[model samples]
Target chain A: MHLLVCGGTGCRASASDSIVESLKQELENKGLSDEVQVIMTGCFGFCEKGPIVKVLPDNTFYVEVKHEDAVEIVDEHVIKGRQVKRLLYQDPEKKQSISDSKHMDFYKKQIRIALRNCGFIDPENVDEYIGRDGYMALGKCINEMTPQDVIKEIKDSGLRGRGGGGFPTGLKWEIASKNNADQKYVVCNADEGDPGAFMDRSILEGDPHAVLEAMAICGYATNASKGLIYIRAEYPLAIKRLKIAIDQAREYGLLGKNIFGSDFEFDVELRYGAGAFVCGEETALIHSMEGLRGEPTIKPPYPAEKGYLGKPTNVNNVETFANIPVIINKGANWFNKIGTEKSKGTKVFALAGKINNVGLIEVPMGTTLREVIFEIGGGIKDGKKFKAVQTGGPSGGCLTEKHLDTPIDFDNLIAAGSMMGSGGMIVMDEDDCMVSVAKFYLDFTVEESCGKCSPCRIGNKRLYELLDQITQGKATMDDLQRLRNMCEVIKDTSLCGLGQTSPNPILSTLDNFWDEYVAHIKDHKCPAGQCKDLMKYVVIEENCVGCTACVRVCPVGAISGEKKQPHYIDPSNCIKCGACIERCKFDAIIVK
Target chain B: MSHIKVKIKEKDLNTIKQICKSFNNEPKELINVLHKTQEHFGYLPAEIQEVVAQELNVPVAKVYGVVTFYSFFTMLPKGKHPVSICTGTACYVRGADNVLQEFKRQLGIEVGETTEDGEFSLSCLRCVGACGLAPVVLVGDKTYGRVAPDGVKAIIDEYKK
Candidate 1:
C-alpha cells in the first residue's frame, strides 16, 4: 500500500509537508516503512477537504488528515490492513463517510483528460512520468507517423486553443508547417495572467513533462528546430519543474537531437514574462519574448505567417499544449467523442469565488453552469444566494440565474454574453454588486492596457471614470447610456484581444443588472454595500445603549455619545471604515 | 529629471555582463537579461538599466520602456521583507482588501510603498494560485494563508526583529 499525500501549494501552506514527515516517521517506527511507501503528489482537486492522503491498491481516500492522525493511520490501517472510518471522505449530502472517492459528489460529473497525470505521478521524477505512458505519443509521432499525419490527427480531433480564443489547434499547426522559414519556433504561453485562474500553473507544477513532450511533438510537426516557453517569472515553481523536466528529457535523449533514430532536432529554451497581462495576446507575447515592449500591433500577417523575430512561429497556451500529447496517444477518434458537437474534449477551470469548493476542476465542454456550480463546485459558500458567475476573467462577462442551464462551450458562452477565457470561473453571490464587479474588471483592464491602442488606453480610462461616478452615486441617468455606448466603441476599435473583450464585463452587467446600476446612481445607494463612498455608517437609535466603545474606535471621531445614552454618528466625518460597528456591543451600527 | 549616478558594484556588473553574453548579446534577449539581472540585484535601478542598454547595444529608452511596461520589473527597491498581499478577484471577494487595508493602517504606508525604516513594504499581487488559502500574505518567501485583519499584528510582530 502507498500513501499519497497532497503536495500542492494550497495543501503545503496548510502544513501538509509536516504531515508527510509524521507519516514517514510513524511507518518507520512500526517497521512498515518498506511495506508502505509515502509519496507526496499534486493537488487532488478537492482542495476544500485538502491535506488529503489516499491509500492506494485499496483506493481509500482520507480527507482533512492532520499530522497527529499519522500515527493512527499507520497503527490501525497499515499494520492490520483495516480502514480508518473517521478519516474517510464524508459525503456532504448523505452525511456518511465514503471509503472510495469514486462515489463522491465532487468527482462524479468530471472527466480528467488534461489532468490525467496531475495528482497521480511524482513530477520531479521523470521515470514515474515515463512509467505512466509519458513519451509514447512523441515516440509514436516520430518513429511511425509523418509530420503531416500528426497535424491531420490533431485536425480530426477538433481540439481548439484553451487560451481565450477558440481557434482550431491543428489549423494553426498546418499554417506554420506550410510556412517556409529557416528558423521556426513553437512558444508555450505559460504567462497565465488571468486574476483568479491557475490551471496552467497547477499543470506545470503537477505534470511538467507533459508540456515539454507536447512542445517537442509540436516542434516535430511544425518543422521547428527550437522551442521557447514564454512563462511568467512569477510562477517560480512551474519554472523550476520545467527546468528539471527539460534536463531529464535531454538525459533520456527524447528532446535533444535525432530522437528515436529519426532526424528530428528540437530543443526548448525558457523565456520569462515580467508580469504583463497583455503578453497573453499573441503579438504582444511575441514582442515581449523578443525583449521589446509587450504591445500589440495590427494583425494582417498573423503570428502563423510572421512571428517571433519575423520567423514562422506558433503560440499555444500551456493548457492547449497539454492536450496535444493526449490527443496523439489516444487517437483522434477516441478524443473527439467526449464534449459537445463543436467543442470536443474537456476544459479545466480554476473554479473560485463564493463557491464551496474553490479549486481546479476539469469538466466536459457541454456541461451546464448549473451542474458546474451545484454539483462540481458543491454550491455557494455558507448557503449564500448565487447572483452571477463571472467567466473568462476580465476578457469575459457575467452570466445570471436565467443562464445557468445553458451548456458551457465556446459558442454557448459567447451567446450568453461571456467567452471561455483561460477558464477563470468566479462565482458571485447576492452580496456582490454587479456595478462594482464591472468597475473592478474595468479597473484591471485600465491598468493592463498596453497604451498601444487609442480606444483601449483612453476609452477604457473614460469608462472607468464613468464607473467611478456611478459607484460613488455621482452619475446621472444619462451617464449609464454613455457607459453602454463607450463599451461598444472600445469593443469595435481596439487593437488586440485585451481591448476587444475589455468591455465585455460592463456590457454583460448592463444587460443583466441594470437596476443595480440605477440603485447606485439614482437612489444614491450601493445595492451590495461594497462602494465605500456611497455607504453611510449610521448608529441605530433604538439599539445603541451609549457604550463609548464606538467613539474610541472611530478613527475620524465620527461617533460621539454620553456614558449611558445612545451614540450618534457624524455621517460626514465617518470614513465608512466599519470600525464603529465592530466596536459596538449591540448591533447598532449599520451601513446604508 | 536630474541625472543621478547610482553606482553598481563591479562584481554585480560582471554578473550582468556574463548574463548578457550567455544570450549571445542579442537585443532580443533584453527581457531575459533584465530578469536575471533583477534576480541577482533585488531590484533594477536607473544605473543598471543604462548598463544593460549599453551591453545589449539597445537604446536606453527601449530598455526603460520594456522595464516600465511589465509590472514585475521594479524601479524602486523593495524592502528587506517585502509584504505582497494577493488582490486577485478570488482574494478580493474573500476580503483580501480589508487585510490589505489593515496592513497599510498598521505600517502607516500605502500599497506599493516602503516604510521609513525599510523593514517592510506593501504591494498587491494578482494571484499566487493558493486560492484555497484565500487572502494570502507573503513576507519574503513565507506564505501566511487565511489571513484575517486581526492576524496582521502577529505577522508584523514576527518580522520586527
Candidate 2:
C-alpha cells in the first residue's frame, strides 16, 4: 500500500511536509516502512480538506491531517489493517464518512485532463512522471510520427489555445513550419498574468515534464531546435520543478540534440518574466525577448511569420502545451469529443473569490458556470446569494445569474461579455458591489498598462478616474456615457491585448449592473454599502443596549454616545472602517 | 584596470555575467535573471535575453515570454522604489482614493508614473491581501497599512530617510 500525501504548495504551507515526514517516521517506528511506500504528490483539488493523506489500493481518503495523527494513521490502518473512520472526510450534507475521493461530490464531476498527474505523482521524481506515461508522447513523436504528422494530429484535435485568445494551436504550428526561416522558435507562455489564476503554475509544479515534453514535440514539429518556457518569477515552485524536469529530460535524452536516436534535434530553456501584463501579448513578448521595450507592435507579420530575432515562432501557454501530450496519446478524436465543437478539450480554472471550493479545476468546455460554481466549486461561500461570476480575470467581464446556464466556450463567453482569460473565474455574491467590481478590474488593467499606446495609456486613466469619481459619488449621468464611450475607444484603438480588453470590466458592469452605477450616481448611495465615501454608519437606538463593544473596537474613535444611550457615528470623523459593524453582536450599526 | 575606466568590451561580458550570476546556479533562475537584467536594462533586448538564456542554459524565447506575463516585474527599466497603493475593496472603502490623491498631490505624478529623477515610481494594486489594515502603501518591501491621507507625508519621509 502506498500513502500519497499532498505536497502541493498550499498544503505544504500548512505543515504537510512535517506530516509526511512524521508519517514516514511513524511507519519506520512501527517497522512498516518497507511494506508501505510514502509518496509526496501534487494538489488533490479538495484544498479545503488538505493536508490530505490518501492510502492507495483501497483508496482510503483522509482529510485535514496533522503531524500528531501520523501514528494513529499507521497504527490503526497500517498495522491493524483497519480504516480510520474518524480521519476520513465526512460528507458535509450527509455527515457520513467518505471512504474514497470518487465517492465525494467534489471529485464526482471533476474530469482532470491537464491536472491528471497532479495529486498522483511525486513531481520532483522523474521516474514517477515516466511511470504515468509522461515522456511517452515525446517518445511516440520522435520514434513514430514525422514533424508534419504531429502537426496534423494537433490540427485534427481542433485544440484552441487556452490562453484567452482561442487561437488554433495546430494552425499556429503549421504557420511556423511553413515559414522558411533559418532559425525558428517555440515559446511556452507560463506567464499566467491573470489574477486568481494558478492553473499554469500548478501544471508546471505537478507535471513539469508534460509541458517540457510537449515543448520538445512542438520544437520537433516546427523544426525548431530550441524551445523556451516563459514563466513568471512569482511561481517559485513551478520554476523549480520545471528546471528539474528540463535537466532530467536532457539526462534521459528526451531533450537536447538527437533525441531517442531520431534525426530530430530539440532542446528547451527557461525564461523568467518580471511581471508585465502587456508581455502576455505575443508581439510584446517577442519584442521583450528582442531586448527592446515590451511594447506591442502592430501585428501583420505575426510571431509565426517573423518573431524572436525575426524568425518564425509559435507560442502557446502552459495549459495549451499540457494538452498536447494527452492529445497525442489518446488520439485527436478522443480529445475532439470532450468539449464543444470549436473549443475542444478541458480547461483548467483557478476558481476563487466568494466560492466555497477555491482551488484549481479542469472541466469540459461546454460545462455551465452553474456546474463549475456549484458542482465543482462547491457553490458560493457563506451561503450568500449568487450575484454574478467574473471569468477571465481583468480582461474578462462579469456574468450575472441569467448567464449562469450559458455554456463556457470561447465563442459563448465572448458573446456573454466575458472571454476565457487564462481561466481565472472569480465568483461574486450579492454583498459585492458591481460598480466596485468593475472599478477593481479597471484598477488592475490601468496599472498593468504598458503605456505604449495612447488609448490604453490615456483612455484607461480617464476611465479609471471616472470610476473613481462614481465610486466617490462625484460623477453625473454624462460621466457614465463618457465612461462607455472611452471604453469603446480604448478597446478599438489599443495596440495590445492588455489595452484592447482593458475596458471589459467597465463594459460588462455597465451592461449588466447599470442600475448599481445609477444608484451610485443618482441616489448617491452604495446598495452593497461597499463605497465608503458614500456610506454612512449609524447605530440603531433600539438595538443598542449600552454595549461599549463597538466604541472600544472603533479604530478611528468615530463612535460616541453615553452608556446605554445608543452611539452615534460622526460622519466627518468616521473613516467607515467597518470595525464597529463587525464588532457589534446586536446588529446596532446600520450602514447606509 | 581602473574601477571606473573599464573597457567597453570587458564591461559587456561583465554585465552579462553580472546579470547571469544574479539568477544563481539554478537553471530555473532564468526568470529571476531576466527580471534583474530588465531591472538593469530598461527592457529585455534580444541580445541581452539571448545572453541570459545562454548563460543560464535556457532558451531566449522563454526569457522573452516570462518578461511579458506578470504585472509587477517590468521588462523595461523602471524607476526605483515602485510605490504601489492598495485600491482593493477594503482599501477603497477606507479612503484609498484620498491616499491616492495625496500621492498624486505630493509626487506631481499620477498612478503608474515615474518621477523625473527616476527615484519614485507609483502604481496601484488590486489588493495586497492586507485588507485588515486598508489603504496600504507598499514602498519597496515595507507595507504601511492603514495609511491615511495625512500619513502619506510621514510614510514618504521614512522612505526618504
In the range A1-592, model 2's lDDT, one tens digit per residue, is: 8999987755665668899899999989888889999998877767656678999888999988999999999999988989989889887668899899898777887788899999899888888989999889888988899989999999999999998899999999998899987888999888766655667877888889889889888998998988988777656678888888888888988888778898778888876666666778888777655545567889888999988878888999989999999999999999999999889999988776677766678889899999998987778868888998888888889999999899999999999998998987777788788888888778777777888788998888889889999999999999999999989988999988888898999899999999999999999999887888998888888999867888897766888888878888889998776768778999988887
Task: Tell me the number of clashing residue pairs for each predicted model.
Answer: 0, 19
Per-residue alpha-carbon lDDT of candidate 1 for residues A318-405, written as tens digits (9 for 90 to 100): 9998898889999999999989999999999998889988888999899999999999898998999999999999999999999999
Q: Which candidate should be chosen as best, given lDDT against the real structure?
A: 1
Interface RMSD of 2: 7.4
Report the Cα lDDT for residue A471, model 2: 94
lDDT by residue (B33-86, candidate 2, tens digit) is 656665565555456656667787766666666555455544334467768886
Model 2 regions lying over 4 Å from their true place: B1-161
TM-score for candidate 1, please give it: 0.97
Q: Best DockQ goes to which candidate? A: 1
The TM-scores, one per candidate, come to: 0.97, 0.84
Fnat across every predicted model, in order:
0.75, 0.13
DockQ of each: 0.78, 0.12
